[model samples]
Target: MSETFVDLGFVTAPSGVVVLGMAGWIDYWREVGEPLSVRAGVAAKAGGGYLREEECEAVAVPAAADRPLAVRATTEPSMFDEEPTIATLEIELGLPWPEGVDGPVLLGDLPVDRSGMVIGDGVGLDAWTGQEDEPADGLGDVTFWGRYEEDAHARFGGERIPHPGGVDGVYGWLDVPMAEAVALEAEISTWRGGVWGQGVAGSVEPHVDYFRFRRAGLHHPLNVGAIEVGGCQVLGIDWCQGDHSVRHHGGRDWGQAFPVTLEADGTGGTVLRWTIPPYDEDEEG
Candidate 1:
């Protein structure tokens, strides 16, 4: 079968770079503390220092960060041979499922993925914070994640529930059908590069990292996208530029992920395929 590619849209890189990872930065600005205030052109001033929102390109909303993020939708999940752990630093993982299993891990309920806005010359999570590095060549890492819980389970965790896909009465209703081996398939095409997609890609541009910083540990899945004004991810760090924009196909309905089957393999190894869209959180409603 021909390779199926999906474009999520563009991510603005006004400073010539972008940061990708979990929503830890979002948690910092929106939840953890008050945002920084703009002191000058595209720069938010803090006690320690500031970051420049210099524009390498024009954008929408006069400064909003935006960009195109595409994905290689796949059903063929890359299997691990030795079940290697993906981290070096040990930290707590607040997962609902046990460790050791192929899971579409949801980043929402994370105990890690933390950040602060500090760094030397002012680049780090908070202060002591500076722009996190993406490959100097303008590329970041990409990988896959599956839920640590059961691959297939009814959306509501109940066996009997009518209209499992919609709000029969209220949100979190038990009527939704079970989702198995399901996930937000990714590895962006258009807007590529980042520490990780968290759940999606950012497609950051080169030299843009100077103004962008990301946190480590836990985060909401869409945190990366939230950072972009399409151009502005750091709050209070403002500038005079048009808003950046992006396009995505994450609006597909439940169990309606796009699929492309591979030629049958007789080998004993398992080959699973999945059809996925851009993971539009709007569909949850």
Candidate 2:
């Protein structure tokens, strides 16, 4: 049989330069008994020694600070984590792989094979905070996600044309029978980089991670794909700018793909399990 596989490149690009490498002076502005504050931007002075919104950029408040109003101000360069631990995503494809194993490695920077790839509708579940990443009680598709791409040059407000051949990859969804499709409900879960503690903190661009589906059912407003098979396995990578962006596929690590597995556990229901690689956290820094 011919190979039934394809690769779709990532949608967005990644950041290249290491933010901390640049040389800049940062003044550590702190009060004796106040929460350590990291000025984000400019603010104006509202009261005594207080910079208002115009004079400063942004400020961070520690959860465990003694003084409620004690703030810090300085003209020093800020230090941020270049690679922040974003979120984790997992979804169980009910059907087994061709050899009872996982599928091929997907590079996110590759281009979607419009001819072979099917951009179907799909949904995203808010499951990170829950046991099973599924809607607690909703029967129908609750969350929906879409697939979109921003022209690299347009995003940067540049006039450079993307390299010839654009990108190359294949993506599509193959539906499992209704009985099987219904048997497999999305147990997709995702997590994002949270509050930046003293050990770690940073900001992120507004970009949605999309999973295009082939099987149609319920879809997330910002997700991609159709729910057909008993389950699904998606692929992509964290990307960075310059040559590194090409490497990451989209500031994501194409090297790893989250695999969510669901199987019958004797009683005819489903047993779900997911595997995610260990990543760096803010603590223990």
Candidate 3:
């Protein structure tokens, strides 16, 4: 079950290993640890960088091999840093809106009661490159993941990018229409935090890698997602965008959090399973 439109471009990793590439994009990925980098604050992702050859719309469904998978604002109020904070790291593979019309909603859970999150050390992640003065980089376990806005050549079919009044992304209405193509699955497990049993993500020795992005579905409301920093990593920007070139065996598994799953196979199609978990041990401390 593989769909298409072609030309993918956007991904990163470095905190433990998650990869998202933002914060100015000189290579990005820096912050390791400091108490959630100041309560999950580092204010990264202005334009979120990387994505060219302009081409959107993607899909996938191959199985086997596994592994893998944010925040914004960064400044603007002064006086020895009075009080400033802005962060956005979207990653929704279909949320609470799953009682019918399909199943499986565990991208990260915790929308209210799905309760469960832990991508290693409880997601506060550290060490891929942290604090040197702190201007960039925050959390991304396992090491670097790749993909950057090739220069924002944004172009995804075009027209229709309204919806924006708060709730930055992951908004669902499901009238159904934005699924022209964008599915690629192949992430059995590559976290090992809880050891394959604690909410989710508990396996290892399965890393051929496979992480795409920009697979947020539904156009009715169109608050869709796919940006692990601040905003606009191609969120229906150019609109009908497309760029899917997968091989199956996989080779990219860092920022699998921003929307990048590649497993190969063939079937009816229509599968969204992402209930991630694993990272307790006082968050590996």
Candidate 3 segments whose C-alpha is farther than 4 A from its true place: 5-8, 19-161, 164-285
lDDT of 2 at 186: 28
User: What's the alpha carbon RMSD for model 1?
Assistant: 23.6
- Compose the digit string of candidate 3's lDDT tens values, residues 1-285: 112212222222223222222211111222222333222222212101122111111111111112222111112212222321111223221112313433222222111000111112112232222112222322111111112111111311112222222122211221212221111001212222223232122111111101111123223222123333321132221111111111111112322222322111123322222222221235321
Q: Write model 2 residue lDDT over 1-285, tens digit each, in one string.
A: 111212221111011000010000111122222111222111101100111122111111111111111111111111222332212222222222333433332211112111112111111111011112232222221121112112211222212221111222111112223332233222211111222221111111111211212111112111222222112222222121222232223211234233323333344322222233333344211
Best by lDDT: 1
Which has the higher lDDT value, candidate number 1 or candidate number 3?
A: 1
Any idea what lDDT model 2 has?
A: 0.19
User: Largest TM-score belongs to which candidate?
Assistant: 1
Residue 46 accuracy (lDDT) in model 3: 17
lDDT of each: 0.22, 0.19, 0.20
Q: Clashes in each model (backbone N, CA, C under 3 Å)?
A: 80, 73, 67
> What tens-digit string does per-residue lDDT give for candidate 1 at 220-268?
1111212323223332211101110021112122232233222112332
TM-scores of the candidates in the order shown? 0.20, 0.17, 0.17
lDDT (Cα) of model 1: 0.22
Model 2 worst lDDT run, 10 consecutive residues: 16-25
How well does candidate 1 score on lDDT at residue 121?
Answer: 11
